[model samples]
Target: MARKRGLGRDDVVTAGLAVLDHAGIDAVSLAAVAERLDVRPPSLYAHVDGLAGLKRDLAHTTTVEFGEVLRDSVLGRSGPDAVRSFADAYRRWATGFPGRYEMTLLPIAADDDERRAGARLALGAVQAVIRGFGIDETSAIQAGRSLRSALDGFSRLENADNMGRGDHDADFAFLIDLLIDGISQAGTQPPGPA
Candidate 1:
């Protein structure tokens, strides 16, 4: 097949993301991407190394995309109100883009600068919200993990179609309430052993 006249790496990544969002991660093969781009699989090699490389790139971009979702979700917001916005945004994005959201869970290697930065960008956004409750820097990491654990667990359950599906909004509101209450209490407590 003739190489597309103006194909580029970003085009490939965008095509991969489309395939992922439409099908799933497993469907983002080089052939699939190339077919979508109207190019041959080998044509992707000029832009991406291969399937593995393409997936790595996809993960990086997806992570950054999610971070942007988070940052935008809480812009000009603060405190528990920010937490509610953060959770709502998180759930909406995670459930809305199951395939891409899964990419955010991929492990970022030490040398994966782009991927690591993307993760930091995403997590740091949430951490910033966690810190809004007036928790100390040292304690915020633990608190952030706890809050993320709750959000991740709930989103995963909802994605799996296994949740009771009864009032996810109210359920998320209740989760945020528990989180806000706990964070408020934690901020007031003296440092204690984990």
Candidate 2:
């Protein structure tokens, strides 16, 4: 196999993301990425450790991006409006990049500082949404977890075409509205980090 010029770690990762997005995780391999980059499969090792290392990098990159997207979606908004925007953005990102979104479910080892940092950003965004409901520190963590659970379940169901015969958009809207109403009834305290 001939060496491909201008190949780099980012190039390999970009190719991996493209292939993963286009053909799903099962199609993402060193050979596929190298083929996308017009390089030999062995050439990828010069940039990434191997397939596992490449996947780790992909996970880290996508997690950070996911956090940023969620955080940005609610910027300049507050309360129920913020919750709506954040929830909608969550679904959009998940559906848009289903393969990368799946990476969020995998373990990010405690010692992996970069991945941990990314996870923190994501957690912070979720916590902020729950806090927007005026949930205090005492309830933010639980509320955040609950919110994530709801979103994850619906997203997975929708992606798999298992959301029954109902209108998904209406069901999602109702779910968000239910959450807003419940949180609103819980008492409106000032928003703060848990």
Candidate 3:
């Protein structure tokens, strides 16, 4: 109970993530994390402000972690290939860590710079795909929003086992192809008279 040598904020975050993985978001409490770390609850206050602070940290950490997953997935890919890789990476992460994935969507204030940047990093992955499609800045924002929404909706449904029983893998592949095709066509479309 001597502060557990080498224990730090990252350790707390890792412990919290473990709790999240095993028992869901609601199970991630200071006491739970402390217990996981073999320390008392008050000891956690030294590493994290409190439950709210811990959750905030967890949100930022997980957002970045999710973004890293995305970025890594498309490291050598571009265009429709990046799109497919991004989609596959996202679904795998969402389904693998449903609790943490939900935390990524939690509402946070705009002033939360670290959290905002982490979230943006994840979105940046999608923007990379949009960029591959040659979409301009004006169109990229809208395109990113649509792609994120579609991916989130599909992942949530698929994670909840609500995607029906007709080979979900194929369903996801088809969905990705449809998204890529849509983006490809949009890129080729002549701009409307303006």
Candidate 4:
């Protein structure tokens, strides 16, 4: 019979996410998680290589969770309806889980499993949106980048409490509508000047 691992990697990752959700990313150290789990800091090495590894895993986990939210929100929808749903989900995820949402801004690296996982999750969300418009892969990627930029910008601003006074919800809605119009135009635009 195989010996059971005391603190599985997934458990550590999950705990790390909890730490992130409750506190900010900076508070999620192996020692911190160890304290939360009532284990020695050294014991965490068996489950996670180090703090960096934990951060990577947390990023991967956050992305996967975000992907599920997007999938559920955008499925069976199309056109502006899908776009609006996706945008709302994205904003909700960001506002609801600020620390996890901040992980999306981390720089991706080659040869990193977490990076691949994060990419997969992000791409899955984009594909969900792309499917709504029946866009090709190239166009989908472009549109995805645009949508991500817009959402990220708005969320970051809001999280920083820089949205400024006067009906932020109205402003957010207008931005979403603008993005939908932009995406629609891009979908129908002809290639290059004649």
Please give the clash total of every predicted structure, in order.
Answer: 0, 0, 0, 0
Error (Å) of candidate 2 at residue 7 is 0.6
- Clashes by residue pair, model 3: none
lDDT of each: 0.87, 0.83, 0.86, 0.80
Tell me which of candidates 3 and 4 scores higher on TM-score. 3
- Over the stretch 48-69, how does candidate 1's per-residue lDDT look in tens digits? 9899899999999999899999
- Candidate 1 matches the true fold with a TM-score of 0.94
Model 3, position 11: C-alpha lDDT score: 94
Better of 2 and 3 by lDDT: 3
- Tens-digit lDDT track of model 4 for 1-194: 23335768887888788899889888999888887777778788888879988887787777778877887887888888888888999998898899998885677667777567756766776777766776555666777788989998998899888988988778989998988877776667653222
- Candidate 3: Cα lDDT at 24: 87
Worst 10 residues of 2 by lDDT: 185-194
Question: How well does model 2 score by local distance difference test?
Answer: 0.83
> What's the lDDT for residue 169 in model 3?
85
Better of 1 and 4 by lDDT: 1
Off by over 4 Å in 3: 1-6, 190-194
Regions of model 4 farther than 4 Å from truth: 1-6, 113-118, 134-140, 192-194
Give the TM-score of each candidate: 0.94, 0.91, 0.89, 0.85
The global Cα lDDT (0 to 1) of model 1 is 0.87
Which stretches of candidate 2 lie above 4 Å from their native place?
A: 188-194
Model 3, residue 153: C-alpha shift (Å): 0.9
Structure candidate 4, residue pairs in collision: none
All candidates: CA RMSD (Å): 1.5, 3.0, 2.4, 4.2
